[model samples]
Target: MKPPFPTLIATAAVLTVAVTVAALAQAPDPPQRSAGSPPPAHAFPAPTNLKVLPKNLTGEQVHEIMEKWKIALGTHCNTCHAEDKKNPAPDGRPQLNYADDTKAEKSTARLMYKMVEDINGNYVSMVENSGVPVTCGTCHRGHITPEPFVAPAGNYQNNGPPPAKDGEAPKLPR
Candidate 1:
């Protein structure tokens, strides 16, 4: 004799759900990031006050771009982005006020970004088939300020010895 219709229907429903869940469980995981590679561009929410970069970037993309800047300038986030002392994050780290322009470094960084953009977009493109773009590292070389001059050796040279004072001998070259 056949089983009751209600019991059969319930059993079928349960089996169907179980089979679907099992199939999903067997599905492969998402791809993992390689060592030293930046996280996926869509990892975080879009940040605010992006004057140079495109405004539609995802949080992850913002972070990755910032990482590039940090490496280029040999600096951390606090170099340009100021920390909000009053409103700390839940993790106890000072929350960065990304939109604030109180720091002079932030202003300078904006100018630097514009300069790099101009160099790459205007100057670099003008060189036929030459795709080399100038960046902060081109000048900074891992330093905050690029050294303008190499240290000179020995004492500074003069045209001739100074005239002798009444009590002093004429200063002569050794």
Candidate 2:
């Protein structure tokens, strides 16, 4: 059953117009958020605030913070604390033979080291020192650099009043 030529042309025009209108009405929009994603939060704008733990403490507590600092430094511990069966990786992070006093400023490895004064003239022990050096937090505020994402805690605006905008109409439904 073929329609007349004029009728068929009219139907095709209507169909094309309908398709165009539908496409415009249902046009895709940019993404607002991803699936399985958490809401955004405000982060600390600055680096962490470093706190120096008091030196007068039990050996266990001091060692605990030191261990924490070690973990905070992440993967760099091996370059310093690794067991040296032979030469101390001479050309590695901190040069093993660089006249002893140049440990901090010479290499790109200060992020992984704590400034510790020698405890004894005879031996290198921790607790006997007159003054201790800076730990990892001495540079990094909390131990972790570029701190983790912190979610904003609460919604500041409550259901008190409607938001006001300039040049707007007032609705009686309020």
Candidate 3:
């Protein structure tokens, strides 16, 4: 006698799950770092170029900050840092020269950083109960260039021009 349809379906599902679990279990373990060994590929070396950023920052700290900026601007290291043709990685990829300021974007980044610092220190601090500090991501929103803001149509309280004078016809938006 043939097995019921539900029994066959259940058996196939169980077999599929078993095969998946076995494959996952057989997968190789990720490489581990050893004591006294060099840092991994993702790790940054000692920072040589200290301009806008504080000189006291360690390589790892700078790396973390740069990673945040990278995500904020939706760009990579190559956007500001230049490629070092002379020193290529073991895999033959050109390494970034973090100190190189040949690119205009790097200077612009420094200026923007200063602006943010000033705004946060001088302006944001003055606001009552304002905990949020401005960041590159605030304006950039994951784009190299910030998108222009378009005001919503029609006059609304607080958003549009002040309430029209009692006698004057309601002024239309220019």
Best by TM-score: 3
- Please identify which of the two predictions, 2 or 3, would achieve the higher lDDT against the true structure: 3
TM-score of each: 0.60, 0.21, 0.68
* Rank by lDDT (best first): 3, 1, 2
lDDT of 3 by residue, 25-85 (tens): 6643213233334456566567787888898887778888999999999999999999988
**What digit string (tens of lDDT, one per residue) describes model 1 on residues 1-174?**
876998999999999889766655664322333333445544455577888888887666777788887888798888988889888988997878877888899889889989989989889889999767898888887777776855455434444554679999888866
Q: Cα RMSD (Å) per model? A: 11.3, 29.1, 13.9
Give me the runs in candidate 1 sitting further than 4 Å from their true place: 1-43, 149-174
**Per-residue alpha-carbon lDDT of candidate 2 for residues 68-169, written as tens digits (9 for 90 to 100):** 755655534333333444454546543233123333332433323323322232234444653544445545555445366454555323333344567775
Q: Which stretches of candidate 3 lie over 4 Å from their true place?
A: 1-41, 153-158, 161-174
Q: Could you tell me how far off, in angstroms, the CA of residue 142 lies in candidate 1 after the best superposition?
A: 0.9
Cα TM-score of candidate 3: 0.68
Question: How good is model 2 by TM-score?
Answer: 0.21
Q: Which pairs clash (backbone N, Cα, C closer than 3 Å) in model 3?
A: none
